[model samples]
Target: MTTLYGYYRSSAVYRVRIALNLKGLAYDQAPVNLVKGEQRSEANLARNPQGLVPVLESDEGTPLSQSMAICEYLDERYPEPPLLPADAEGRARVRALAQLVACEIHPLNNLRVLKYLVRELEVDEDAKLAWYRHWIIEGFDALETLLKRELGTGDFCHGDTPTLADICLVPQVFNAERFECNLSAFPTLRRIVDNCNALEPFQKAAPSEQPDAG
Candidate 1:
């Protein structure tokens, strides 16, 4: 069996859940309790040196770290209901969109970075929120423009079918809404997210629906 170690609200973990659902794979979930600092526990650190949620363990004897790498592993191992497009150009475009969110948006808002603001830099709640909202708006604006202007977009981020881009998009949108980022401007992103939610797999994988959601 494939075992996923993750925290419900962790956007990194959220990405893995979306990939698992999209691939139509059955796997067991083990909540890592990120807020409680369990991710830094020896057990978790053994699986992921970065002290991060979403370390995917396969029965094949290797546990994977990094959500994107784990996602690609699933894509290669399963090879059905493909998560990437067939054509090379389409695949690159999809991966690019996914990277724009996973790399550009997520890294800045990481929990450790936020904690540093409060503990070291002495940032207040309002200032911390401002920092978070600023990044979301900037990232989302660029993402929305790409999605709306690109001819590849249809019912999903890359095409009518869910792909790597949608896997990255949904988790980021969930985080954005959680932080109360005003999303009224991104109609295209909202439409794609709404379609994703309408599916059982995506809905089932939502943070609120997870076994560890609190």
Candidate 2:
């Protein structure tokens, strides 16, 4: 059986869960407690050298790392409900939107970076939260503008159906809310996220619903 090694609250892992759920694929979860530093253990490092949550063990027993790569792999292997658009231009747009969140916003705010800020840089809780909110607002500002003005916008980020963009967007939004980031400025983003959350795929993949959720 396919298995996912990840923490319950990890947004990266959350992304994979949504993709797997959308594909209607059944998988077992192997929780690696990030707070306990279990991701850096020998077992997890063998699966993913980066010490990251969300190492997906394929049915063939091949381990895959990186959330976006794993998501694309699932889309390619199970093409029933495509996560990307059929057209070349549409695919490019969807990837760009997905990257805007995954590459730009998430990197600066992920657990490792936040841990480094507090543990190494001696950042206080207030300052750490300020840093988190600042980047979220900065990234969401650009995302909101693009989604609002882009003619391709539909019920989801790219079109009427959920795509890779929405898959990436929802987890980031979840983290932003957890950090208490003000999202009042991004109504378009909220509207699209609301649509995504209403679906069973997204709902089933929610962090709170995970077996390892604390």
Candidate 3:
């Protein structure tokens, strides 16, 4: 069986879980407790030198790193309900949307960055939270405009069905809400997230549903 090495709350890991569930793939979870610094253990380091949660060991025993890459791998390997669009243009748009969050928004607010602020820089809790919310608002502002104005957007980020964009969006939104970031301005984003959470795939992949959620 395939196994996922990840933390329950890591957005990157969350994204992978959603993709796996969407693809109807059954996998085992090998929790890497980020809070306890288990990701840095020699075992995990052997899996991924970057020491990040979510190193997916494929059924063939091939280890995969990076959430986007893992999701694309699953999409390619199991093409039933495609995660990307059929057309090249549509695929480009979906990738752009996915990267807007995965590359831009998430990197700034990632747990490691936040830890650096508090542990290394001695940033207070309030300031750390301020830093988190700032990037979230900035990114969400741009994302909302694109989603609302783009004719490509339907019930999900790119179309009526979920895509890579939706996979990235939902996890980032979950992080934003966890930090109490004001999301009233991003109605379009919220609507898409609500639509996503209504599905069983998204529900099963939620952070709370993970075995190590406690």
Candidate 4:
């Protein structure tokens, strides 16, 4: 069977979990305690030199690193319910939405970055939280505009069905909520997240539902 190495709370890991569940692919979870620095351990480094969570070992024993790559791989391998749109333009839109969160928002607020601010740069607790909230608000504001004003948004970030954009969105919203980021301004983003959460696949992939959740 396929095996996933990840931490329960990692947004990137949460994304992969959702994608796998959405594809109806059965897989085993091998927890990597990121808070304990297990992601930097030698074993994890052997699989992913970047030492990131959500390393997916395929059923054929080949390992895959990076959440986006893993998600796209799963989509290509199992195309029943496509995560991307059929047309090139639509696919580009979906990818842009996903990258807005994964590349812009998430990287600035990731655990490693936060640790660097507190441990290395010596940022105070309040400042650290402010740093996190600032980026989330900036990113979500733009995301909300795109989702609300742009055509084709439905229950999910794309059309009526959940797609890659929705997979990236729900986890970011969860992280924002976890940090108590004020989300009243991004009603459209919240609505899409609410719709995604109502689905069984997304619920099962929630951080609270993961085996390694504490």
| Model 2 poorest 10 in a row by lDDT | 52-61
Alpha-carbon local distance difference test for all models: 0.91, 0.95, 0.95, 0.94
Per-residue lDDT over 95-202 for candidate 4, one digit per residue giving the tens place of the 0 to 100 score:
999999999999999988999999999999999999999999999989999999999899899999999999999999999999999999999998899999999999
Q: Tell me model 1's lDDT, rounded to 2 decimals.
A: 0.91
Structure candidate 1, residue pairs in collision: none
Task: Give each model a TM-score.
Answer: 0.98, 0.98, 0.98, 0.98
Residues 73-155 of candidate 2: C-alpha lDDT, one tens digit per residue: 99999997999999999999999999999999999998899999999999999999999998889999999999999998999
Q: By TM-score, how accurate is candidate 1?
A: 0.98
> Candidate 3 lDDT, tens digit per residue, 69-131?
999999988997999999999999999999999988999987789999999999999999999
> Clash pairs of candidate 4?
none
Error of 2 at 169 (Å): 0.4
- Per-residue lDDT tens digits for candidate 1, residues 1-214, read 7899998999888888988987888889999997889989999999889898789986586889999989999999888889999999999999999999998999999999999999999999999999998998999999999999999999999889998888888989999999999999999999999999999878988999999889
